[model samples]
Target: MPVHQVNKTIGEINERIRKGKAVVVNAEEMARIVNKEGKVKAAREVDVVTTGTFSPMCSSGLLFNIGQQPPVMKVSRMWMNNVPCHAGLAAVDCYLGATEPSEDDPLNKVHPGRFRYGGSHVIEDLLRGRAVHLRAQAYGSDCYPRRELDKDVTLADLPNAWLFNPRNCYQNYNAAVNLTSRTIYTYMGPLKPNSRNVNYATAGQLSPLFNDPYLQTIGLGTKIFMGGGIGYVLGSGTQHVAKPPRNERGIPTSPAGTLMLKGDLKQMKPRYVRAVSIVGYGCSLSMGVGIPIPVLNEEMAWFTGVSDADIQMPIKDYGYDYPNGLPRVLGHVTMEELKSGEIELNGKSTPTVPVTSYSMSLEIADELKKWIEDGKFLLTEKQEDIVSL
Candidate 1:
């Protein structure tokens, strides 16, 4: 029967029980519960038989059978169908946990093979992103040797710093040059379970909700129009990419999804802040495990109206101000004096430490107070152990 028809039939049977024209009866049946894998986890055998009879004088007679037992054959059939249903649900849950990819998944275009540069194979730019000078240049580094260039030499005229003597270079060099989608692997939990030899674009395809464009926009500088376009890092993973604000279409559709920046770089020191209010999931922002830092400027603070607090510290002595300074001092604080109330900090009663003082010592002192209260580090034991004992 169709679902609606089955429900209608059940409704009629229920109506018969309510009316005085029906005789009531009782019965019992068997049931079982099973895991998604179709393995039966529980089962119970039951006996069901209803006793009822219709009156001979009644033209429209009713037979009522109720209590515990429905048809065993029908119930068993539904129960078996539910087993596959449960199994499918569980498999989907496991797939979500085990197959989800992360933002750091690398991008490469070519698979590494037995190819040598300058001898048999020619080098090519296989990855996206404009090349920037290495933070530190080493003498005789694998980086391309600097060549004398004319005054008109552009970035294109520069040597390919990425190329190396492939034959003698370390294995790491080869991996860097020839990496491709097939060489990528994924991890499940702490274990590297499978070698995912799929296209690089397909890395994080498992998560329908995941969007890297929104992340790339985070901490990016706001563009202030001038006669010329503001400088931008052009290419993959750069902030110049157009990100859709939270709207009808786009990764983020709300203010929380929109990325914002905080702090003035012109100050004595730079600060950074996250303007977007993100919700972390198992690894997302709501749970707060992942660290999404401001790109470069370190001056930062998180502001929630009514109770404003500094979440970022000054780049210089940011450590000192952190736990006992102007900003809400967080982290380890070791106080020699015991105070009864919440530790209030400021110029008035804040304990100041010399810049040269060891931070670990302060941490130790703070821990000592807790130990003393717990009676673990007794004064008498300290005297006996340290002094001529």
Candidate 2:
């Protein structure tokens, strides 16, 4: 057959393969039949090849004119059954099963190691030549729009950059399990015995709150004022008030009793994106976090040792950091430690996005098509499906 026709047929086959609609056959056995002489037939009757000669029958058990045919078939590679060929497919499994390291594949660019544990190694193999998806939960930083507070203080359209200066900050990590609540409590920083602490009194004095029923008050200091100190002053005028208590997870508990990091908590706001610390290191041991999931089907459950009743959620670790942003921190309890209910200090979680293979495949397919159009590939046909195989 002409190379163009052969390639076109191959391309069509590839398309079916890409979509998981193509039949998989043993290349070696198929080659044997293709090389056989007159009256030759396949040792094992494989799937019939479609043929125009068959007219409405549309199929032929044997390849026609094989003795006079030229070799055109090529086997680039093979994949193990039940394995994933791409990260996005793995992510689909991950998203469904709440798997980790699923989003960290190089194709995805979002390191699951920076977030959680476990991997879909076998699935990653099955998705080869397919698509990939990056599981990025957050895309942009949380924007804190400054609202107008007073006539003199005009709210700027620009954002307020709050740089966390670690050197001046206190830091620590603590873990406890509430027997009564049957929940874990992990604490880091300001509340710790020795943590990079944020001195609320000092920060408040710098920007004292203006007395109003709708606003909290703070204190300020001037060059000529008392001790030149700035902070929040008590109603008594002399004493200072500490910041509100952080929740058990070291998160700021909003008035509504929910742990809030950024955004309007009073409105029961949802922070689609925010900057959170993922993990920290004390120069001692390695740390990590893991999320669990229930297997979806009988086959999936059999291999994963989990049932569909399991939840699928990313296990995020609380974060920590040194005053200088040098030492790292992370929220993690080793499998052994967790089983024993023993815990340690971990770091904060950071903003991230959920990714998958389909998302990546689309990007790759687009680029491939562009490349072909740009003469990057020896493509003769304008129709992409013609190259299926």
Candidate 3:
């Protein structure tokens, strides 16, 4: 393995990667390295660490400008795969949120849509090269007298299709367990009644923000794998709750260090980005994201060396009122305990299942490592610091 200067630079790392001398490890491998060799030793030896995650990020959405809707008047309403899209941007531009349901679907009333299909599904179908029904209603205008447009389109048909996520890749997420007498469904996945099971969201130790606690290296303009294509960190994500309480190791306990990201939808693949509708919840985007962390120094190495056993998350009651006050925190437990298949909560053992797949995370990390090794991917400088933003 080739060693970089005390202050490692992206250029040096890229050069080493091209030479096949750069040492890289995924989250799982990093643990073994740190365990046997120690953080300082691993820091001095490894060139980079790969991190990945896939989860139901509701703040994500797809933006598109379908220019083929020729002579289009101001579009008042738009529907993609029966899901209504926000057409307030311009005549050809619209935004479709992952959690947005079709206008015809009720919000939890007389009839349940069961969320058979939604915006996320539409986006996925388009990415899969499948045609989607596009219907638009417009107000007649002088230059464009057309009042309605009907067509079938894929992501390739759009002049510009983009994935613009306002928030994603949460640094740390809450562990949800239901205490009520009935099964409760939340974003963390379905929680059984009487604390039968618990569900967690983050990829645990494999999560990018968790490895880069305090937002040291990750920032705006950083290159990352988003929805199977190359994307850049846009900025600080929305509802990025501030200065969340940290654990003894400085890792956050609450959801934190969220990020905004953007990428060309045309370059994405269906495998990395999928549309999923939660049983009771509406539409949502499930995506796999990969980020490479350069081993800048021993401090950085230590941060990345932190494992699932070290980082902990608070158990929150999904049934509690979220807007008024903080959810009830049953306790702070480590991911190792949560991933052990069951956790002892309040004297009763509760089964814990992961909504995110660790095996999939490994696959993403391996793919990203290959990109780096082939010299196709390089670390990027931050356009702006996320912490200050």
Against the true structure, what is each candidate's TM-score? 0.13, 0.14, 0.94
For model 1, residues 1-389, the per-residue Cα lDDT tens digits are 21211111223322433442222111100001111211111111111111111000000100111111111111110011011111122111100110112222222113222111110000011111223121111122233232221122112433321111101100000000011222222110111112111111110111111222233222233211100111111112212123333322222211112111121111101011001111110111000001111111101100000010101111111222222434331222211111111222322233222211122222222333233233332211011110100
For 249-362, candidate 3 gives per-residue lDDT tens digits of 789887778899998888888888987867765668888899899888777787788899988988887765432376668888899998899889889888888888887877
Where does candidate 1 stray beyond 4 Å?
Answer: 1-114, 118-198, 201-212, 215-389
Stronger candidate by TM-score (2 vs 3): 3
Error of 1 at 137 (Å): 23
Model 2 quality (TM-score): 0.14
Best by lDDT: 3
Report residue 269 deviation for candidate 1 (angstroms).
29
lDDT for each residue of candidate 2 in 323-349, tens digit (9 for 90 to 100): 233323223322223222223323432
TM-score of predicted model 1?
0.13
Full ranking by lDDT: 3, 2, 1
Minimal lDDT window, size 10, model 2:
51-60
**Candidate with better lDDT, 1 vs 3:** 3
Per-structure clash totals for the candidates: 16, 80, 2
lDDT of 2: 0.19
Model 3 TM:
0.94
On a 0 to 100 scale, what is the lDDT of residue 259 in model 2?
A: 8
Give the Cα RMSD of candidate 3.
Answer: 3.0
